[model samples]
Target: MNSFCNVKSVMRSMFSGFIAATVILISTYAIAETTMEKVKRTGVMTAGNSGSYPPFSVMEGKTLLGFDVDLANELGRRMGIKVKFEVIDFKGIIASLKAKRVDTLITAMTKTPGRAKQILFSVPYYDAGLGALTAKGSGILKPEDLTGKIVGVQLGSSGERYVRSTLGKKVKQVKTYDAILLAVQDLKIGRVAAVVNPIPVLRYNSKGAQLVTTPVWKRRAVGINTRKEDADLMAWIDKHLSAMKNEGFLERLDKKWFEG
Candidate 1:
């Protein structure tokens, strides 16, 4: 009877140990399987963008075309996965990425300290600076000229940050727009004295939009953004971006989208 009781106790202990080990193993695997593995397993990677920013991302009829679009396709090709884009509003794009509605953000999103806390930014893929656009002959030659004038800027953009932080009390009123293009429209109609946005965007639109792009402000680096937990995906993107830079792919993109 004593031998039988010892045998039963040993069996119970073994079963409990096995259950605990299995639970730990499962938990470990769950932590190890991240977005990188998901992308590889599903054979698809979805990129998020505002879809309104031209030269970077824009909609032509029903099709999306821009530098960011091409870059996303290139990334997918390199990764041997199909790529798709989710056109989220500019203000909501980051939230969409955080919610895992998209695998990455392919918008020309700048890296800011504030944004760094919420998401991971890959190695910079592009560089740009803030530009102030005014109607021709508006007499706004420098930053000081914007004092006491109503200014328009895209909501949640680096341009908005500059206006709020640098031009704070100097400007009369700040008007936020969903799309920078709309702010340009307001500028054309005299709704705002000036529109602050990315230099590349302002330069592209100034050609025949009856607008002038002032000297660019401080430079900002634009990078691919992913959820904080998707560090592996972010690193993977950085590696490919390095390869693209080395092979002059980025230069080609610059020529196609930015250069004259």
Candidate 2:
């Protein structure tokens, strides 16, 4: 009888432990379901972009459209979500992502070593080099011509970094606007002798402006940005961009925006 009693007690304790384990598993699964369900239920993925940047993002009257916008829409379609564009300043894009104001940032942002620490970047979707645009017939022909000249750049951009690093203390730096177009405008008015920006952006925004470009530096990759810990979303975006590159979708978009 004593042996039977001991056996029964052990059985009861084992059953209780099994029940607790089951409860924990169920709770974990419930939490995961809740997190993933929000994305599908909402049906819209909010994307942050600097709409003032041409070729990558811009406002065509009331409609927001450009390479980044199209790419965001394509990503949403692949993810089975509708896309909602939120135009934000370039300088504040990372802040907005951290604050959860947008799901992702698909602006023409370079994948730099410093930014990699703060945000998760999807696989590179494009490659661009740093370049300077000067008024046509202006004496500034090469990177060296920028010496001792006032150069305008978008605040907090790689363009500014390139100029500072390359020109050292000779070039006067001006942070006029978040958009490269404004800097180009300043260049036209002789406020700044040259405007430094991504080669594609400067070309896209230069319409009727007497602008000529000289390559200053190279950026190895450009990528979409998402908040840290968004691993699933980042993985999905990486796969999607990879497919776009493989299927020639990216090339088509590039030609339409950059070559055309």
Candidate 3:
């Protein structure tokens, strides 16, 4: 009888220890914050962009407004932190992010090999293509049509890359501007025969110009870029983006901003 009682007591102690270990395991999985948690603990998320880029991130009367702006704020809100956006020249956005001046990039930045080497990109959120904007009656109907003509493109943009690689040699000159809107301005005034930019931008900024859909670059995707080794932050971002896509929120943004 004594031996059986001792065995029963030992079994109870072992079971209690097992239960405590399981609880600790569950707590660790549940509470161990990933990279995202560090950002949350700091109570802030900084996003970088070139606010001069219209439709995606534009500065209007001291207020930053556009699709990317909204999306950045949404991510901040979801993360339960305040979002601060840093607007600078497009060429420096990636540099600033790399230097840790900002947490991530929110501009309509394309996912390219060169960029990927510096930072990790979230799943693509938007697809952009290089398009031409020509003044009315300019006769710039297509990529070939712009041959031997001065073409304008936004500095540090995919449009600029497309022109340099595919259209620059044929064109009289490849004029680079700080913003696509500036290129469109030049296009309207005959400074260049055409302005090369993303199609969605041309859709909104082509006042006296006609958008030529014969693209120079086709279907490049845009996504938020985070610092290397930011696995938790990247995971959080992807999960939120996927949820938005599934819920039709992303579609609504495209319709409201890109289509309009």
Candidate 4:
């Protein structure tokens, strides 16, 4: 009877030890699975953006600067990770996301139904719309006036779509150098009649081009782009955006870039 009791006590002790070990292991894995932990483990979060988009993103010398750059840096800081910006064409942004070349896309990408099919978008951090930029002396002012004239636009952009849908096939199309800077150097030199792009981008990039913008479309919400299956990262981004909205960061950024 004494031996049996000792054996039973030993068995109970071993079972309790096993359960405690399992609990600790599970907790450790849960901590490791956190988004913040994952980012830290990777050391840096790769972000995609159209580097030519001024105010939102632009290459100042060799360093990328602008609202999107600052926003991505802030997000990385909050996540306790470093950020590396990968400048990519606008049309290839989503493809890069799928290829895992970048962890997220911080470009001024509009949240459209077609895009939503392939990727998940965070809560909108900015509102933008299609607009036309013409030289100060150019007669073009509205969408209708663009008929039969060469209009420069970034390929695969909403501005391109809007122009195609609104102006039909008769309108002359001039592709810009990239997906962000619709106003190519030639456009300012009379190579193209006018450039169409998101209003905020046009206004931001038009420093001394003697440009005038005509607001021709409603505002579209802009959000961060992530892979569809990255629910953890998506939730983290949504929370961050919500907090920024609540704290007026979004408004502050808009004022700095758009209102100023």
Candidate 5:
């Protein structure tokens, strides 16, 4: 009778332990869906951007346009789903992604060593670097010429870091704007001496501003940003970009947008 009781108690304890372990695994699995799986399940992927950078992503009378817009759409197409873009602030993009507010980032986000610590990137899709735009004929001949002048960059962007890292103490003041367009606008109105950002952005919005030609700082490869845990989705994006490069599809896109 004593032996039987001990055996029964051991069996019950083992069963309870197994149940606890099973519960934990289930809980983890419930919240562990890959970005790709979630996209497929919902029939859409949300691409986040500021919609403030032109010729890459911009808001034109409620319609989003530019290279990144088409890129997100293509990504969705390849996955056999639809893509929806959320106009989030540039500074909040990464936080939103980590919090699961976005499936991927299509903003002109560059692949930097610092950013790589928080997010994964697809292969480089464009050759990109930083440039400065100032009021026409401002005599800011080179990047170094910005010394003693106020330079503006979008807050929480590589441009901000570029000035601090490359031109630290050379410039009198570093102004930060919520949008790179605002930096450009400030440069136009003499609020800031210059706006530093992607070369494409500076070039496209240089209508009333002058683009600096002497120095292209912070040259980098730009790619889609995904959550670090979404290995499957990142792989898919890298593969898609690779195919686009090999098939000349990316060339056509560059020609249509950049060459235009």
Candidate 6:
């Protein structure tokens, strides 16, 4: 009878330990801070952008101005929080985001399969494509004309991917730059035969800049990026962006920046 009582006591102790462990696990999950919750608690949302990309995000005499900046400001207004910008080079922007240096990316980053594997993308906010910028008389009217010529592309961009993957072994050399403007500069000095970047950007930069533009290679969707774990934050951003589109806020921005 004493042995039976001892067994019952041991069972009770084991059961109590299991229950305590389960409670602790539940408590940990309950207290885990989501990205949206942190934003609300701190009253600020940090957004990353390649500030060199113009009409999207750019520096104007020490002030950041552009379509993306305006859009981010509007997002902050709707969230009842202030938005902070982290200007990072396009090459390292994704790494900065994964390291939590910024909460989200508004850098006109295109949605790609490889990037989607590393980060969550909000609903697409814009569409853009690759185009070549060459000297006015360079005779590089299309992608085919780029064979055996040195080309410049922004590092980590779809244009770079296309050149390396599609034009591999055809081009003499592929030069990379931190910014598209740098690539364009190289093209101007004959350092590179052509510079590839977003078609809209090429058009914007080529205006009276003595550069010739090529037809677009392909158009892709651009979306905001966040850490994969921040589903709630992603949902919040998508909801607001959808609302902005529906309300014609996005159309006005297009007219002000892209069309105007």
Give the clash count for each candidate. 0, 0, 0, 0, 0, 0
Candidates' C-alpha lDDT: 0.89, 0.82, 0.81, 0.79, 0.83, 0.87
Report how far residue 157 has shifted in candidate 1, in Å.
Answer: 0.9
Give the winner by TM-score: 2 or 3: 2
Model 6, 1-260: lDDT tens digits are: 99999999999999999999999998886579777888998999998998888778889777889889888899889878888998888889999999989999998888878889999988877888777888888888778899999999989998898889888989999999887888887888889999887788877766777887887887778888899999999998899998988888888988899788
Q: Clash pairs of candidate 3? A: none
Quote the lDDT for 36 in model 1: 88
Write one digit per residue (lDDT tens) for candidate 2, span 1-260: 99999999999999999999999998987667532355677887778888888888788888988888888888788888887888888888899988888888888789877789999888888888778888888878677788778889998788887777778787765555677888988888889988888887888788777788875457657898877878777877788889988999889999988988
Candidate 4 residue-wise lDDT, 1-260, digit = tens? 99999999999999999999999999999765744456667878788987877788888788998899878887777767788899988878889888878888998888767788999889998877878888886777778888888888887777777777788766776555564554556577887887777787887777776778886565678999888878888897788778888998888888887778
- lDDT winner, 1 or 5: 1
In candidate 1, residue 103 scores what lDDT? 89
lDDT by residue (1-260, candidate 5, tens digit) is 99999999999999999999999998897688777887778898888998987788888999999899888788678768888999998988999999999999989898778899999988989878777777667887577888999999989888888889888998999999887777877777788888887777677677533445436766878899989999888887888779878888878888887767
TM value for model 6: 0.84
Which of candidates 1 and 4 is the stronger one according to lDDT? 1
TM-score of each: 0.86, 0.81, 0.81, 0.79, 0.83, 0.84
Q: Identify the leading candidate in terms of lDDT.
A: 1
RMSD of each: 4.7, 7.0, 10.2, 7.4, 5.1, 6.1
Question: After superposition, which runs of candidate 5 have C-alpha atoms over 4 Å from their true positions?
Answer: 1-29, 208-212
Model 2 misplaced regions, further than 4 Å: 1-37, 137-142
Candidate 4: lDDT over CA atoms? 0.79
Off by over 4 Å in 3: 1-37, 208-217
Q: Among these predicted structures, which one has the highest TM-score?
A: 1
Q: Where is model 1 more than 4 Å wrong at Cα?
A: 1-32
